[model samples]
Target: MKLLNLQRRMARAVMTPLTHSERMRTVAPDGRSMRAVASQIIKPNDRLTSFERLEIYNRQYWFRVLSAFAEDFPGVRAVLGGRRFDAMAKAYLIDCPSQSFTLRNLGSRLVSWLQKHPSRAGERQNLAVDMARLEWADIEAFDGLREPSLKPEDLAGVNPAKLRLRSQPYISLLALRYPVDDLLLEVRKDSDDLDVASNAFNERHKRKRVGAVAKLNPSAIFLAVHRLDEDVYFRRLDREEFAILSALQAGKPLSAAIESALRGSLIAVADRAAHVEKWFHTWAALGWFCRLEKSPKNEKAASRQ
Candidate 1:
């Protein structure tokens, strides 16, 4: 019973934060206390208490996470400026405390949070939100699972009727009105600034402006956010292409997606067949489709005939 109690005490001691009194009791088996063990960490000339030694770890923990955040959202930092960025970072850290052991998960809620309370506050709010999402996609693409390309031989024996397809882990589709991709590229070059002056696109006046006009167009854009060969790529797709890809992402068969792609317009009728064929080849080459589905029991089930 005494040994058991000692073991429990030892466990609690290790788990809890060490106070000065507790630190004195945390001795080595050879009779040296933790204070002795941590002599190097605690300075001799200073007036700092034992708590101060441990406070260094606390400060460092927040610093590293903040630094990682700054690295992940450099464009955000540039847009917010230094003082506002620091304030935002502190507020963000408080509202959404770190849940993961690594700093990679730090910015997971950032884009969503920014959407709720935008930093720009005016016309640039949507643009800022879009940029945040783009930055998040870049970070997520770097962290997600990377699967080996499926062998061509694997598809050779497959029957199309009984098949179901899955999207790659790193692929995400975003529909936004903001020109986020262009803004991110501009920010990276450290030349362009976010313009929030105009509220609508005037095509007649826009065409007259040189070197990319600062007008907000109200047209909806379908974006494919994916990583290929370790680099993030964002491409804007036309309405039909977007519909087809969205259908495919929903696990609809290739033929069905193609039909959906061509459902509305007479103009798309002639291009449907060729578009479907090319899309299949494109998805295959880009490794965007997966054959294995993760079941409710957490087991992977291959598409079966």
Candidate 2:
């Protein structure tokens, strides 16, 4: 085989999913004996056969990928029991394998995959989806881009009718059907002690903790996943607050964003002005707003290394 063809064949063999016992299958999907295929590409060492040598690479590839997926979505695993999470993760990865050079994007398609394959999530499908969304948002916020924030002086005298602002690139707005934020934080706090396959920290324990099951009852939850310094945080938002921020992030002017926030608001028109002022003050303090225009004179953006 030419060098490129040989490299492709090796990658295909390594990426082939392992069996339930985490062993390389004896036969490839094309019905070729794995031993024969291995012999063609690998030379046997003193203590190992060609098949055994190839099996090592195959197992390691899957082990790392599975570990990466688990690390990114521990909250989802908590929602779905460990075993089911493993099975669903394997199936999802087989269908949507990592396409990026880094493992950071491995679970990027997971929420959609769960949506399509609801059976994979069992009884708590919505909860699982929400947990996945929140977990993924955490990932996005941690490594997301940062630009110079609009400071108090920068916004001074700016008119809301014409003010054009953008949300910090790292601020992720999420609308969810469950109170998954609590569950996610709880899961992550104790994740280090939980064994993935043995259900060492089983779902039953979750139900007992302050009625975790009841806490997960369907509710409209809006959140902003944002970073301060080096750590990420989940901030609960009022429905109107979520709407206003999302509208602003969509490139709407301050006046129009406020209008969008008012469309379905339950807060009275008289009460809204105070709430709006408070929201803008809080968001501004958090460095959530960025100037839409850029110039060399603009303060240089700081990025996490």
Candidate 3:
């Protein structure tokens, strides 16, 4: 075989999702004995056979990928417990192998994957999905690209009807079916406490610690996940406020976004007009919007002034 073809074959073998013992079988389900294949391609060392040497690479690859995946979704792991989380992670990796160079992208499809394969999560599927979404959003907010923010003063002269505001690139607007932010925060707190306590305990008296999975009642939750400086925060939004932000994120102009917000039953018709100024003030103060999106005509008109 050509050198490049040989390299690709080795990569495929190493990345193929299988246990070491399964790969060592004489006649595997794939019809080719992995041991036979390994012997044909690999040069065995003094201490190990071709299959044993190949298994070393396979184990290391999986261990590193799974470790990074677990680190990225600790909340999901907490919700599912160790055994189930391990199974789910293995299944997810088989289906959605790492396409990106960075380990950070490992759990990118986790939410949707959990939704489709709810059986993998057993009874805690919804909770798992919600936690995955929140955790993934936190990851995005922490490292996602940043856009220049518009100051509160930037909107002073702009007409609300023609003004289109762009959301900050790092900001994420999520409408979840459960109050998962609270659950995740609590789980993380408990995990941190356990870590501290474990360090101080004598080895003979140390016990295995598991996170308490709480029963959370389902409720519609609107959240804004964004970063301020180096810290990420989860801000709960009222229904009306969420509608407005969702609309703006979808490229609606300020007037239309406000109309969308007011159409929701959360805000009374009389109160919407009165609240518009206050909402914009709060959103601007939070640095939610990056800039006003101006049309070519508006740009030309402003240039002539």
Listed in order, each prediction's TM-score against the native is: 0.65, 0.89, 0.88
lDDT of 1 by residue, 253-290 (tens): 65566667778855556776686677667777888776
What is the C-alpha local distance difference test score of candidate 3? Answer: 0.78
Each candidate: what lDDT?
0.61, 0.84, 0.78
N/CA/C clash count, model 1:
0
RMSD of 2: 5.3
Clash count, one per candidate: 0, 0, 0
Candidate 1 off by > 4 Å: 1-46, 49-58, 119-123, 150-162, 191-215, 265-267, 291-305
Q: Write candidate 3's Cα lDDT for 1-305 as tens digits.
A: 99999898777777766654434344434676778778889999999999989888877888889899998887788778767899899899988999998888999999999999999998878878888999999999998877778886666666666667788888888998777787677666665677566634422121122222335466788999998876899999888888888998897877888887777476666777767778778877777788654677435434554
Better of 2 and 3 by lDDT: 2
Question: In model 3, which runs have C-alpha deviations exceeding 4 angstroms?
Answer: 20-29, 199-214, 293-305
Between candidates 1 and 3, the one scoring higher on TM-score is 3
Worst 10 residues of 3 by lDDT: 202-211
